[model samples]
Structures are given as C-alpha cells and as structure tokens.
Target: MASGDAGVLRQVQALFGVGTVVGMTDAELLGRFLTRHGDAAEVAFEAIVRRHGPMVLRVCRDVLGDPHAAEDACQATFLVLARKAGGIGGRERLGNWLYGVAYRTALKARAGAARRRRHEQKAAEMVPEAQAKERNRHDFAPVLHEEIGRLPERFRAPVVLCHLEGLSYAAAAGHLRVTEGTVRGRLARARVLLRDRLGRRGVAPAAGLGALASSRNALAVPAPLIEGTVRAAMQIVTGRVAPAGAVSAAVATLTQEVLRAMTMMRLKGITTGLLFIGGLVSGAGWLTHHALADRPEGQQEGQKAVPAVEVPDRDEGDRRVILGTWTTEIVIPRAVDGEPQPPLRLEETWVITGDRIVTAQDEEALKVGAVHESVYRYTLDPDVTPKAIDLTEPGWGTFPGIYELDGDQLRISYGVGERPTEFTHDDQRGPFLKTLKRVSPDPRPVTPLFATAPGGSWAIHPDDPGGATDKLTSTIGGVVLLTEDSPDGSLQVTLAHPVDPGAGPRPEYRAVAFDEDRRRYLLEPTLGGTGGSARGGVRVSLQRFRMDPEVLPEEEIAYLGVEIVTPGALLMEADRAFERAEAAGVEVLPPPRVGEPFEFALTTMDGEVVRSEDLRGKVVLIDCWASWCSPCMAKMPGLKALHERHDGGFEIVGVCFDKDAEKAKEAIESLGMTWPQVLVPDDEEVRRLWSEGSMIDGLPRLLVLDRRGVLRVDCAPEEVEEQVVRLLGEPGQPKP
Candidate 1:
C-alpha cells in the first residue's frame, strides 16, 4: 500500500473488507475508486488491481510465455487503466478492456523481445538442429501458447476468452460483444488455424490443445503479485517517483511501445487526411513539407546540412536570377584501374519563361544521331529547407527536385521518378546533382576572348563544386572545347572524349556556342556521343571556354546556363523520337491484366534459374517487392501463412527488387520464407516489371496464378491470401 494518507487507506481497506471485492462488479468498484480524490484514488486504484490483476496477468502470461514478463506486462496494463480511469465511462467491462490491453501490451513486449534477440533468431536459422534440441525440452503448453498468440487478432481473442478463461460461448460473446454463433464460429476457425500451425512445428495438437484449454495445470498467479503490481502502477500513475527494477523497466518499455504504436497510427491517419486535403488544395505549399516530413531532408530538420548540398537560398522566390546559363566544372576521380584522370566539365542551361523551364546543353555537347532537349513547366516552394522544386515535362513526367542557389553559384538536384530529398549521388539510377555557375553577357563567343588562343588553360575557382582548381580549362575553336589536365601532365583531356558507336548512346556533354544575332555568349546544344559507360558515381566538373569573362578572376563564376534550342525545335525532337518509337512497333503494356499469363524468368537468391513456365503445376503467388517497401514487408506473414497452409498445392515466388543482395537474402532467412525468392539484379528491369507489367505502382504487389500458369489476379497485398485460396480451389488447370 502507498504510505501517503492513513485515513484514506483505512477507508479503502474497510470498503474492501477481506474478500469484499468478490461480489462487487468491476465497473462498480472502479467507479467507487474513481470517485475518490487524492490518496483515496490510490487506494481505490489498488482495489481495482486486486480484483482484476490475476486475470490480466494470466492473459499476459499466455501471450508473453514468461511469468515474470507477464507480471511486468500486467503492471503496464493497469498503468494504462490508471492513466485512463476517468475515461473508463462506467459502461465497458473492465475485464474485457484490460484483456485487450494486456494482449496488445504483451504483443508489443514480444516484438521488442524479438528485435533484441534478432541475432539469436539468425543463429536459430543457421543451426536448426540446435533449435530442435532446445524446443525438445519444453512441454506442449508453451508451444501451444506461442502458436495461439501468433493467431490473427479476430481469432485469437475468442480463443483466449472461451478456452483459456473457460468462458461459455454466450459469456465469451458477451465479453467480446459478438453473437454467440460468431464466438463459436471464430473459436472453431481459431482451432483449425492453431492446429495447422502446431502441426507444422511437429506438435500433435489433439493432446496439447486439450491440456492447454483445460484448468488441469494452470499456473497460479503469485500471491504478492496483485499488491506489488498495484503499488508499482500507482507510483507510475501518480508520478511521485521514478520507476525502478526489471518490472518497472518492463512497464516503461510496454508503455512506450503502446504509446509509440498509437502515435504512429495517429500520424499515418493525419498524413492520409492531409494528403486528401492536399488533393483539394493543390497550391497549398505546406502540404508538400508535411508530406515529405517522413522523407530525408524533412526528417533531418534543424540538423547540420549535408556537405554535398547548401541551405536553400531565400532569394530563389524570384526566378529571374535562375534564368540564365549555368556551367559545371567537374573533376573526374582517378579510375579504378589506377589511371590518373583530369577534371571534366558539363553544362546545363535552363531558360525560364513564366513558369516553364526549357533545358539545354552547351553547344559543345557530344551529339550522335539525333539532337534532344526537354521543356518543363516548373514550380518552386521556397519556404522549406532544401526548397522543393517540381518540374513537369509534358508527355514525359514530373521530376521532383530540391535546389539551393547562392548568388552566382547554383546547385540543383533531381530524380527520375521521385523527387530527391537530399543532394546525393549514391543512387545513380535514382537522382543526379548539377551545380552551375551563372554566366552573363552570353558567354558563347562571337569572337574568341582569347584573342590569340592556344589550348592554354584557365584556372578553376577555389570555391568550385568540383573541388579542384588547377585542372580546368576550355579551348576556343569554331567549336569550343573544355579540357582538364592530369596532375602529372601525363594526359590533357577534352570533354569530347571519343565514344564507340557499338555501345549504347551517351548522355549529352557540355559545349559552347556563339549567338550571331544576340551577339552575346550563348549556351550550346549538347554534343551527343556514342557509348562510354554512364558515370555510375559522382563526378566533379570544370569548364574551359572560348571567352574569358570581361570581369576579373572572380567573375569566371558568373557564366550562366543559356537557352540552347527553341521550344519549336524541342517539340520537333520529341515528335521525331515518338515517331521513331512508333516506327519500331513499340507497344507499352499497361499493368498486366488479371487472368492473363505472362512469361518471365529470373535467377533465384539461391542462384537457381526459375521460370513461370517451370512452375505450371502449382498455384503461384508472385510477390514483387523491395526491402525498403513497408507494405511489402507487412504482407510477408500472410503470405507465409498461406504458403504453409497449402504447402503441397501452392508456391510463392518472391521477386525481390532490393539493390543490396545481402539485405534481401537476410530478410528471406529472417522471415523464414521457404518460398523460392527470385532476385532481380537489374533495378530497371525490376521497376519495369512493377510499373509496366504488374501495373502495380507500389511494392508488396501480388500476382496469383492458377495451376496451369494463367494469372488469376493482379491483387494488392491484403488480397493475396484470398485470391490464392480462391485460385487453389478453382476447378480446372490453367493453360500454360
């Protein structure tokens, strides 16, 4: 008992005279206690615990599989009740609410335990024989409880009420507030699930479940447990002292877990609601910040900014300064083959007209068979850190990006399919960064500023994004050329490195051009080239040009990205490309139709080649996923259950799109996924299958195929089991 008030404690003791609580309804006792103030509240709280603690502890014990842990979880449950006692509303059955809370609390503890012992889980997988030896020592009750706890929430509740607590069907129904028939039906279904799960673990269910449900050998709740829990819960609830001991720590952990779960659920709800609202108010800039709060830069609010990116420039609200040509001076790192390499310069010109941004490369760009450019109508949200920039290219797609412009220095980064939250070069296929020095006076030379020009180099600025100064130069010709010098002078390289025609087409490189009519320096069309490998990693750049700026040394940074082609010319190029694709008979498939089979073959994580055709005789669930996808991970348990239930008739093919093979393999092993997992090494192919073939825009995509290899459903993750079961029960074999 708490040592506070003697009078209130004595009164509470009199109210609960020796076993007096036995006949009082839980709500009545709880109401009596809640009505009291101060010290009396603590006494009444203890009375509530004494009445309900055993049952809550029992449920926790069943769920958590350890008595000590159960007591701790039990304390945590009452602590929740104590905190929310005023809201008990006097209508709910205290037992039922506590039961649910206890179950969830215990479940949370189990998840924590699982996370802490994840390494042990890996060991269990690697040494299964040792696991078998360990499980052999435990009786069936523990195993039975483990299986029961793993049951879906709907089924598990009835099983706990009707079987463990020995509630009659009507009583269980009353507690669960369901029809008696519903209670009975759920218990029957629960039994079947439990039996199946236990059978897989090599435990004979008939004997174990019978013993588990009966009161023959139930563990007694410890005598001091109720009072200890009440005292601990009261101390926690009142906040008079800090929680102490293993039990106190457990209470803290469980409370934190429950609160964290509630917080996340609420956050998701808020995010979803905000997203819906964002749809209605498309121009609401705050929505973008909130929506991206879960992403990278938004996640790192108030932290030190990454070295690769600068803080957003408050001046970017006026897009006029961003209108001109910006060129990149790059320092290519030494090759993996240990060959010394010189800096490389690339340039991009963005000509802003109203809301539209026309993108062009320098005139010295390496061009191959065709000239290409793009026009994007853009929007900028300047309020957020690493301000959000969205660009929509007509007939292509929207490119989301972030930008930070510091005076003449401009850094803009963009991703292909998704907006980049950070300026990073880690994901080559994902996002790319371009830093430009704004050039003025149309730096494209009508007359070379070099006067009497040789290929002599100009010095790169010390503050350049490329991080090298002595290496950059541009040589003037009828066509301007940018070059970098090796430190040893072993090689002097120009931006026009030769590319083999046999290889795939190269992305455009920066070049310079003179505008005769404007008589100002102008940004050039990119020089297209044949194949060299795409620079898979970060490249720093410096540019040598035909003209030195009229200003002194620091003014070299003033070169701007200028418009290279007219909108009419860009439209012509897009039309030509479209015509070429049309001529090739390109037929882009939409997301695949349900009940239509498509052929695919890929290498499994185990290095075995597997094809859809090879798995014709079984029901196949093709799970297209990536490790980073939460929805995909969330579906694993259901898929695993389905795989287990229909082991002989069904097969699950996990098409993992993870770029990191180790993480993908570890997920498979940790999830204990026995299904054959296909690892798609090529990210582009994985994305194509997801976006074009599967037609599913998100991860955790599931495709069901009948026995004859015909796809039965192109379903969401939640629909996987239902579709799989329906397909398995279908009458005829599908055509291969």
Candidate 2:
C-alpha cells in the first residue's frame, strides 16, 4: 500500500537532505534518509516499506491467509520499526530487524485479537439481539485489529512481517531478531491458529485462507490477484466487512445505473418534436452564431454601441427545458497570440435519449481529449447552486451549461456559456461537482420507476426475480462471503466473491449502505461470527439539521486521528518539536481554544500548566514543531502576522511535543519567543495526545482556531495564504 500511493516516496524526497538524489544504493539511501529525515524516522523507514512492502505483505498472507488482515499487520509492523529506525544496525541487518519487528507486531496483534474476542464474548452475553447486531458490525474490524494483537508478541510479529508483508524468511527473521528457523516455526504456528479461527467460523480451508490472502496487495492489483481483486473486493466488502460484498457490488450498482442511463440516452431519438420544445437542448448544433456588427450591412461608420447583455442568475434554481438533441458544429477561431485555440463557441450535443436525459460530465474539465466515460447521479440542490454534472448512464455524460428559465421554454448554453460556475461538494467526492437545472421539461424522459415520492422516499416495490439485482448479496461457494446492511433498511444482504488468484484486485464493489431519507435504520456487521469494519463503505450522513449546512459543511472536518500509522501509533508520537514564532518579544495572548478529545493542555512548565481541557473559546495554535525543522522556525513571521492582526479570535501555542524536548527548549529560548509554550510530558498522556488530539504527520501544520476552538480550512495550504490573511484580518473590536 505504501509502495503504491507514492506518499512514502514523496515524504522521502521532501525529507531528503539538500542535493541528495534517490539513486543511491540501499545503504547510502538509508544512511542519508536517516540523517535527513532522522527525527522523522517514519519517512526514512518507508525505505523499508518500499523495499519490503510486497514481501512482508506476502508473508503475512501466507501466515494469516487473510490479505486484508495481513496488510493491517504489515502496516503495524512497519510503524513499530519506523519508531526505531535507528536501532537497525547496518544495511545488511535492516532486513533482519524488519522481520523481527514484523514478527513482534503480529504477535501483539494476535494478542489484541484474543482480548477483543473475550470482550466480544462477554458483551454478546449482556447485549440485546438487535443492539448486538449493530454492535457486531461496529466491532468487527477493531476486533480483527485486536485479534492480531492477541498473537504472542514473538510469533505474531514475524508472521505479519514475513507472510502478510511478503518478506523473505531470512529478512523477516532478521527483523524479528530471531533465527530464520524460528520465523518458519512461528509462521507454521500462525497458520495453525489461523486455521483454527477459520474452523470456528465455519469457513473451509480454501474459503478462509483465500478470503484473507486476497487482500494482501490492496493498493495495486498484482498480476495474480486480478481476478481475486474483482471477486474478493466484491466478497470481502459484503461478506465480512459489510453483508454482501461491497466494493464490486457498489461499482456494479453504479455500472447498472450507468447502463440504465445509456439506455435512456439512446431511446429519445432526435426528432422535430425536440425543436418544438424550444427550451430543450438539441444535439450538437452544426450552425454557427455569426457576430453581427452594430451597423447593419453598408450602414457605414460606427452607428451606435451595443448595450451589455445582462447574465441571468444560476442560483435561482430555474432550469431550461430541452427541445431535443442536435449536433451543433463548433469551429475554433484562429488564435491571435499563437497556435489555434479551441473555439469559445461550445456545442451541446443532445439526443432525445431513452427514459432519461443523458449528458456529459464536461469532457473539457480535464484535458479536452477523448472522454473517459464520465457519469454522475444528477440531482437538484435546493441549498446552493450546482456545477457540472455527469450522467450515471455509461455513455451519456452531462456537459456544463448556463441554463435560464425563459417562460415555458428554458434557454441555455452548454459550456461555460453566460454564467459563473456554481458551488460544489469538493472535499468528499472528487472535484467535478453536479447540480441539475430544472430545465424546460426534459425533451426526452421515459416513465420513471424509481422516482422519489413526496417527502423523498423510495417506495418499496416487489423484488424483480429475473430483473438482474445490481445490489449483490452473499452466495454460497464464494471464496469470500460477506453481508452488509442496505442503507434503505435493516434487511441484511449477502455477497459471495470467488477468487481467481490469477487476476489482481481493485475496489469494484462497496460494502456500504446508508439511509437516504434520514438516518433511520440501525445496522450491524459480522465476519466469521465476529465483527469488523468495511473500511469507508458505510458512510453515515446525519440529517440536514444535524449540522449547519452553510457554515459547517464548508468549515468542518472530522479530525482524521492521524491515519499515518495503524491504529497507527508513533505516527502521532510528538516527542519533541520547536516553533520560531512572531518577533522574539511579541505579546502572546491566551492559548488557542481546543475542543474535546484533546481536552488537556498538557502543561509541563512545572506548576504553570496549560491544558486544552481547561480552555475554551480562546484562540491558539498548538504547534507540534521541531527545532531542526527550518520551515517550522521560518513560519514564525506568518504565525506572528496572524497573531498580531487578529484581535483575539485566536492565539498560537507552541507545544514542543517532540521526542526530544530538551533540543526544542534550547531553540525556543534562543529564539526568545515571548509567548507561552508548553513542554509535553513523556508519559502516556503524550502518546494519548499524539493518538487522539493532533494529526501531526509533519511540522509547520497550521490549525486555524475559530472562536469555537474548531479547525477550519477553505483550501489546501499553498492556496490558503490569502484566506489565512483574511481570517486574520485587521484587528477588530476585542470581545470582552
């Protein structure tokens, strides 16, 4: 996983000492990696991830036989080593040490699993059945994490590093600080325990082992897991993760929706019936709009100037109706500056498609190249203006348009026409947004079968037996089987995915369900009679009123809890950090306000303590910076600029929460930061804070504090400088 995301590579490059190229041999690379990103041993350690991710993952799969589980262990194993990259003696021994860490992590994971099983057993006895089902769903993945924890430290570590991670026997053994022979024996034992787990869960040797083994290389589809990827992704999601396999199932459902859409696009064949409905969009218009000068032909001399045309509002929610489909020709004009540019005249190729209006998701969004079957579920947003939309129909994608209500007929331009772009949901779904204009009655629409009833409800209809059910459920003989709840109801659906080790894997299904009308249905999940997570398949959205759509949707972000590590530890371990802020003697106000979870200010300045739990509505920045971090110290002026400009909306608090506090203190003192700073304790509190409060993947991370002590950001860091300056506008009237 780390190997494919390019994150580790990016981090390594970013952390590399100036002038160091990545072409060095493993030894030279590790050495430089350690020297440069040493404190950030995690970055350096990724070298190991790149070097051994495949093998380590392979080893874990071989041992546990559950690819996903193996990956979990693999991630955990690397996390442990990252914290101790320094302990790795020489280049040659790196492999050995990695294996050792993997072994230990595996054992710990197994032990944790045992503890969870015990806990689950006790809870099952006490909880009611319905509640229990929900609890089971919620507890599955964590239980898996815990079971991995339960394995004896020694055996578990090697098993994960070797089998799940695909490390060679010798490499895993070296990393675990054990003999290769020991690794082999422990792997054998792990298999035994795994088989026992399978037997307890009523899975066959092939089914159980194959189920886990399939998830080993989740990021990229290795040649072998391709078929398994399709089926396993489908099965794991619905079976153990959800109910019916999720990934493939969801994708398939999406595909079916697309297919249905395409079918609709072709049905409403173009006819003069389309033009009769003037507002309706005809196919691509072959005609060109000749710009006529104000002076009529031969009326010589500039007779008069043309008045500016007023653009209509897009947020009014009015839409133009399509008359029919047309293929209008768009001729690009000659460029005055250089090469010929694509013509500004856009064309809307519409066809009276089947039962639904098929549209393009603006093939021009990216490079105006060949379209990549883009599709979207079109919907109208009563809250805000919507932007470009894609049709869920496979071939028919929606084009961006400026639509206006012109009496009964809707008039519109297909491309950026005459209006500005509308608002879109950018954070969650990829960038391209979708909003529908209530265009003149769609020139081409078929009788609807799934139209929402009054009050936004999909009335349940009889299940069509022969009608291919795109919503997949579990089936027997599947290499992997899972069941997930449908968002529409509590009804359980089963999914069975068979694995063909020859094919690689991809997330083609979704083991997710969510209630559309409201968050009504309670759901649960179970795998092998135990519970776990189906990753992000189940996205629970709250009722509209649960959050302020205007402010929060744009400003709120659920703290990711530092996803860098596994249940990732050490990732948040802010042992020691330094921050150079404001002029040395800048007046520092009270600490920035912090929300719950990271309640404590974690004061360590003897007696004079600052804890987040103790402050509210105060502005501050809890800087988890490093002394060696030039960027950390360099951002001082900006932090100062923000502090000085803002009346008291916020303050900046530098929490030298680095692994080495002494060094940080030296820098802070030398820099003469007049503002108050806290030294984090070296106890469980620090670890807890790392794990819970801040998502400290790197230094110079600025968390802007509002009066409510919440973090808000409108864009990425590089692009938000102006926003930050605005957020810290000229000093305002101070709040008493």
Candidate 3:
C-alpha cells in the first residue's frame, strides 16, 4: 500500500471502539472494513486502489493485451469478491486466486471486445518517429519466441499458457482443465505450424529444435520482442494499418513477383516489346505453378499476405529441423524429373506502416491498431512436374486459396478443410508455372430459418420493440454462400443474411449451444421475399439461416438476450434493506427503481448485524462505481456537485463495487465525500443479493429514490442527476 494510505488507515482504525488500524496488513484492514461497513465495500475498494493500485494494474496490463480493458476488468472482478475477506480461502492463496480471476475476467473482456471492435477498428503499426523512440524498449535475441494467438480460443489458450505464460506442460494442462497429452499434442502441432508459417515468411527458426528439449521449460516470448513491439507501439500518434482489398492484394503481390523474376531480363528494355510480352507469359505460368503447389483449402477466410524475412538473413529451416526448434522453412518444389527448383527469394520482413487517427472520444490522444501482416513465398522447378511440399499443418484449419497470377485474375476460392487428423491426399495435374487457379465445385447447400421475439419472422420495423417474437419470418436454402456479412458483430446483424454466397442461398448454420433446442439460422433477401433476423457465433463466424429466405417467402430479424435468470429481483430488495447497512457505514449501488418507500439491505462480514435495509427513508443513492471506470469516475463530480448543490434533499449512500472495500471507502473520503460509505460484505445474504438480484456485471451506476419511496431511476450518475432534477418535479408537484 502507498505510504500515504497507511497514515489515513491508522486514523480510521483509531476511531471509537475500533483498535488502531495503522499497523494492519492489507488483509487485516480489509477484514475490519467488511466487519464495519458491510455494503460499503465499493467505497473501501476504491480507496485500496488509491493505495496499491499500480501493482495490480501493472500485472493486469502485462497479462492482457489491452490496458484499459484490463483495468476495468480488474476493478469489476474485485467488486464481486470484496466482502469475502475470510472467504478468499486464505491470504497466502490471494495471489493465485487473483490470477485466476484476472484470467477469467480477461477472457470475458476479450469476448465482449468482439463487439466493441466495430466501433474502434484500428491498424496497429508505428510511424518512424514512434519506432525510433521505442528502440531501447524492445528485446531482440538470437532465439525469438512466438505464440499462436490467432488460433481458435481453445488452441490459443493452451499454447499461450504453456509458451507465453511459462507454465510446464503438465502445470499448463492443469490450469486449462485439460490432460497433459492434449497439451503436448497441441503444442507439437502449434509449433509445427509456426515453423511452416515462419518459413513462408522466409524467416528461419529462431533456435534449433534441440532448444525445446533443453527447455523442458515452457516459454517466455523473448523479452526483446515484447519490449521492441511495445516500444515501437508507444512512439506513434496512431498505428492503424488498413488492408487493401483481399482478393486484389494477395493475388497481385504473389503473382507479380513471379512475373518480375521470370521477365526481369526480357522486360528490362521495353514494356511494349514482344520479347518482354513473351517473358511475362512464361513468368505468369511459373507464378501460377508455384502458388498452386502450396494450395490450402480451396477458399481463404481472413487470408493475408506477409513480407518475406530479410534478404541477408543467415538462418535456414533445414539446419534446425532436427533440433525440434520451431523454425520457418520455405521449401520450394523440385521437379519430378529430379531437377533443382528455379531461383527464388524467400522474404521475411516485418511490414511497418499504418493509418493514423485521433481518439474518437478524446481527440487529444491517439488510438491505432492494424490487420497484422504475414507473408509466404514459394517456387517450382522447370519440368512442370508437380512435387509435394507441405504448406499447412494438422489441426490448423484452412483459409481460402487466394491467387492472382501476373494480373490476369484475382481468384478467391471457397474455405474448406477437415480436422488435422482427417487428411485427404490427392494428386492434381500440373499447375502451369504461370498462374494459380481455384475451382470450387459448388457452394455448399444449407437451410435457414427466421426468429423473432415471438420466435418466428422479420420485424420490418425493429424500432417497434417489445419482445423477440414481435417480427415476421421466412427461410432460404441450397444457395451459394459468399463472404462473411459483418466485420465485428455487435448486433448479430450478419446472422440475418446468408453466411456468404457460397454457404447456401438458404439460411441454416451452427451455433455454440442450444436455446430451446431450436435450429439457429437467418433469412435472406431473395427478390421481394422478406428477410429474417439471425443468431450465430462471433469468433467462428458461421451463418446458416434456419429459415432460408428462398424457402420461407418472408422473414424478420430476431435478438435474443437474457434479462435475469434468477426469480427474486436483487434491485427490488437492495434499497428496502439499506438502512441498517448504511448506519454501519457501508456504501452500496443505488437502486432508483424502488425509490424512497423502501431501503437496501446488507449483512456485515461476520454476520454480527444486518445493515443496508435499516438505514431509513434516506432518498439513498447507492453508487456502484470503480476506480478504473473512466465513464463511472467521469460522472463523479456531477454527483458530488449535485449532492452539495441540493444541500441534502437526499442522502448520498456510496457503495463501492470493488474487491477492497476498505480501500474503496478511503478513496471515497479522500475525495471529500462526507457521505456514509459501505462496501462488499462477507455475509452470504449480501453476496446472494449482488450475484442474484439487480443482475449487474458493470459499474458507475446510480440508483435513485423518490421522497414517497418509489423506485425512480437506475442509470449512470449523469442520468441519475437528470432523473433527480426531474423527480424534484419543478418543485411544485404534490408528494405522497
């Protein structure tokens, strides 16, 4: 804890009946806080952050890719756990539990982020200036470490824990709730793929395979990579790099390179020359021949082009294959006639350049990110005989084969692949050394259905909302599906359309889990047919409308979400039970829904007393806030100002939704808040209230009550103020 807080804590502990708090450990102070405040844990937790927040934040940020999200998640996770001083199982295990909480919270944040990305898409790259400034921060080692973050969450999770997180194969397995074998297989496959991809980029494995054996030790992404990356990241105002149209970009770069290599000498003199033209044709053939040699599944999903590693690089894939080190080996195909492949330049370079944009909300700052870049180059011998070279690995799914040979065409094939264990070895005719071509047999067929609030069709007018079945419906089937309909799904809007022109004209797709044992799908616009609302996964991004638009004749969009799974409402009771909790000095999230007629309730840590409900008809505003919530904190001054401005028409009952209630309460007081504050309680009743009632998972919410004690407004502080002013009702309305 900060030295400053130690002094203040001593003062609070010295208060009547309470022994000196100055010398207490964080755990002890926390115990006293729960024992004293009950629901006021929010206030105390906030105070705790003011004391030792930096350490917590540093750990969270380093573990999670996003600092802002990490901070918010840390605060929210703590809020639910605040009152459980004794329940933390014990102080010694605190760090472990905290790590578990951090991990889970980060995962949820990542899931939620799939939605936010729409509003904040960025190209993450640095400008020259930022790159220069960060040079000192990056670490570059002879043996660089890499992790497969882009793989499915399942694969990514295990690999990250074992590699980046530095957990033993067994220990990592334990944490992931998987068996050690599963971990080994996953790591083996992941490492193998990483090597291939690195080779494609013309980068040699950073270390020999033998290194993995020696390191029976898990992994730590070379510190240099981390420092260098972040250092490069920090220097720029913005680092977003937008991608060029995929089909166009991938084909043009890959095909053009082959053409140049083949025709460089012939075309050196003239663009209009006949010799030059002939060379171009030959080069195009070579390009097609080489690209087709490493065909991934027919179609590309999120396929991208990467730069080859540096030209003067000394690393070679052949050298490290035996050592078990993960390395990139760009293996060109030799002709069946036993001839060496033609000359090729395997490139491995980090492409650094991106778009720039000021922060949308606060223009003074910048927010930038990008569509990460990776490149793979290939070559073939002169015989035109096809030789096999493995480009993809087992388990790793495939993206569409994007090909563009010497500008004749940019072809994007359908996405296809079986699980790694399910392999299909086939021999195809020679692809001319000229250009790549993909022939998708036919778009897969599917059947799609529509869902509404009433579980039927399209709403035509979604603004007219009431429930899920309040819309119209239809279905589609057996049509060519096309590209994904949405980039980042916030509203599940894409689910309303065919996954692509290839999946099927109809709308039937898969979902992660079942809701009422129903088929998940979408509706499409076929001629004049009405479309349907949809449902599907965000990450996997599959779409199959249950009610295919072609088959349904009509359809509507549907949004299915949860309100509260539990029967008894928590907010309804938070205020009715507040009085006693408040008197004991516990802060609580305000519930404006059930106003002055009732009070919120809470139990102390030791259950010595029930506090929240007994406070009084206090027009209590249980402020559910966090130290890391900018929006929540941003609205604080207005609340304080309103409290002071009105001179106490209502009592400001501050309740922190944080882990360390004592700390939160201290922060509350430090802010000059004269109101009584409470925090999370160790009592089971209070825990049930938060976990079951109100059904909240976020912060900075305000609950207000009317003088007559009716639930009024439950919103942000600013929103609450608006409601409060309106509730005052022009100062002339009759009161109950």
- Tell me how candidate 2 scores on lDDT: 0.37
Superposed Cα deviation of residue 290, candidate 3 (Å) = 51
Highest lDDT model number: 1
lDDT of 3 by residue, 161-240 (tens): 55434558776555544567666755665566556544554455554233323333422222222222222222210222
Q: Candidate 2 — which residues are off by over 4 angstroms? A: 1-182, 190-607, 610-619, 628-630, 640-650, 694-698, 707-724, 730-736
**Model 1 lDDT per residue over 658-677, tens place:** 88989998898889899888
lDDT of 2 at 380: 33
At residue 270, candidate 1 shows an lDDT of 46
Question: What's the ranking of the predictions by lDDT, best on top?
Answer: 1, 2, 3
Q: Candidate 1 or 2, higher TM-score?
A: 1
Number of the candidate with higher lDDT, 1 or 2? 1
TM values, all candidates: 0.32, 0.25, 0.25
- Candidates 1 and 3, the one with greater lDDT: 1
Look at candidate 2 and tell me the lDDT of residue 512: 23
